[model samples]
Target: MFEPRLALASLSGEADAEWARAGADWAGAAVLGGVCLDRSTREAARAMVADRDRSEFLPDDPITFVDDQLAALSGVDLRPGINVRSTTAEPVREVAAVAADHDAFVEINAHCRQDELCAAGAGESLLREPERLEALVAAAATGADVSVKVRTELDGVDLVAVARRVEAAGADAMHVDAMDSEARVADVADATDLFLIANNGVRGRESVREYLEYGADAVSVGRPSDDPAVLDRVGDAVAEWFAEEQSPREVEP
Candidate 1:
């Protein structure tokens, strides 16, 4: 579990060790990449970069990239995690071993909605195939702590039920991109004991407080993660809220 309870969510090509380290003072953990883990997904990720002109981490050797990135963060105090995309469970196990070696966590990418990734059976497409997603989670857990990054409000998909499945697969955390529905955080928290990290529209104390009030154990800042102003505000809010929760209350007799 993340102390300070604030995480920096992965942002495609931009989230690297340097980026995560920049926000280290505020965040307890940083989930890096949306790294393409296998041949099919890596090929798909390349197409995405070409077609969409988006920045993505497309390294020649992805597992080595993961190892290198985590190694770079060795001096940083925050917990390191890798967010990976793959069509099979084998690659997850491979990266999970590297993650375990670094004392890091493995986050399965079930939240991305990229068309190319979806076409390749990666990303949010996993939500529709609960069995595969569970298998991936179990594979990652075999080597290290596992977290499944999922999006909320997808049609015909029940997040609470998915949370249960993820937990059953030995996932230690659930990263929920609550989208437009923050209440889903409470719903998932009610249904499972997995540590919930609420994401989306998290800018300041108001947004952070809302998620915590809805039962989120932590909150992650996505796009603006590198902004010190945002990091400062969110970090302060988290510290203050947790402090109040731990402080002794006065009793009027």
Candidate 2:
């Protein structure tokens, strides 16, 4: 878990150590990648770029890239993390080992909704396959602290149930991208004690307050993570909220 309760969420190709370092003054934690950990997912990432002009972190050796990224953040104060996409547990296990070595956490990417990633049995497709997702979470937990980035409002998929399974699988956090259904944060918070990080459309105090009130342990800034003005606004709001939360309330006579 991170302090100040503010996080900089992963932005596929742009979220590298340099990106995280640039935002470090505002956020308490920085999650890097959506990095493809194996061949199938890497090919899918390539297809996404080639077919749709999407950017991806296509390192020649993902594990080594992970090592270097985390190592780059060793002198930084914020908690560093990696968001990974893989079809099997072995690669997850490998990357998690590197995360452990760097005192960083590993986040399983169950939130990416791209068609190519889903077709490769990674990303949002994992939400439809609970057992496999749980196994990947468990595999990651063996080496390092595990966080599962999940998407909400998917038809017929119970995100609350998924949160429970992730906790049972030894995950330490649940990063929820509550697309349009922000109330789902309360639902998942009600069901599990996993450290909940709420995401999507977070710009200022009102958006930050909504999620904190809904029981999110932290709030993350996605697309605007690099904007200092937005980060200053969100980061200050988070500090104010947590300060207010800890203040003693007086009873009325």
Candidate 3:
């Protein structure tokens, strides 16, 4: 439903305001957080953000801190679309509402694989239970567009089936963190017509086109985006792609 030809996938706590200012100008959309849904998970979120030595130093208001974290980052001048990732336990309408209030898209995180997240039944743990996941998506009460970020290769979980249920629940996009199952993009693409965001190991413009050719509506870059040059390559690729799309096709003489 969104036109972000290239999206910055949720980078957990690594997506600070400084990172936002530098990267926001290039990517089509910028995703902030993997910001946790509740208290226990918020601790987990902070731990994940801090280095091993400074893990216990967070002394701020959690609700305002987390919401404002993304809100402040959204202040970036050039990022066209802003999205926030949250890991929740039950009804997610509240989280979605926060996103709506912030004028941002809300994404359900089913991709983070931390031990604490799984133990708490958040993150990739949701992949093991499709009904619960679908319920969370269906319970969203806001007008903000919802995106479900999924790791398609989770053992025993049918990626296509999950995508179908997400679509049935009226989600706006499916962010597929294809991992090594990049080929499965076609399967997910076939299963739903929702805006598909292909993620993981996107190195260059050709890789972007590869996923698009495989049926993804957008390509998301994660680690490589830490480097500005990589971001430039991604932007150039998208520009060239649009150029090609708008150009007249050749006719055989």
Candidate 3 C-alpha lDDT tens digits along 56-129: 21325534544565577655653323333334534256656666776667677778777766776778888788
TM-score of each model, paired residue for residue: 0.99, 0.98, 0.85
Tell me the spans in candidate 1 whose CA falls farther than 4 Å from its real position. none
Model 2's TM-score against the true structure = 0.98
Distance (Å) between predicted and true CA of 79, model 1?
Answer: 0.3
Model 1 reaches what TM-score against the true structure? 0.99
lDDT (tens digit, per residue) of candidate 1 on 1-253: 8888999999999999999999999999999998999998999888988998999999999999999999999989899999999999898999999999999999999989988889899899999998989999999999999999999979999888889998999999999999889999999999999999999999999999999999999999999998999999999999989999999998999
Off by over 4 Å in 2: none
**Residue pairs in steric clash, candidate 3?**
none
lDDT of 2 by residue, 183-214 (tens): 99999999989999999999999999999999
What local lDDT does model 3 show for residue 25? 64
C-alpha lDDT of all candidate models, in order: 0.94, 0.94, 0.70
Clashing pairs in 2: none
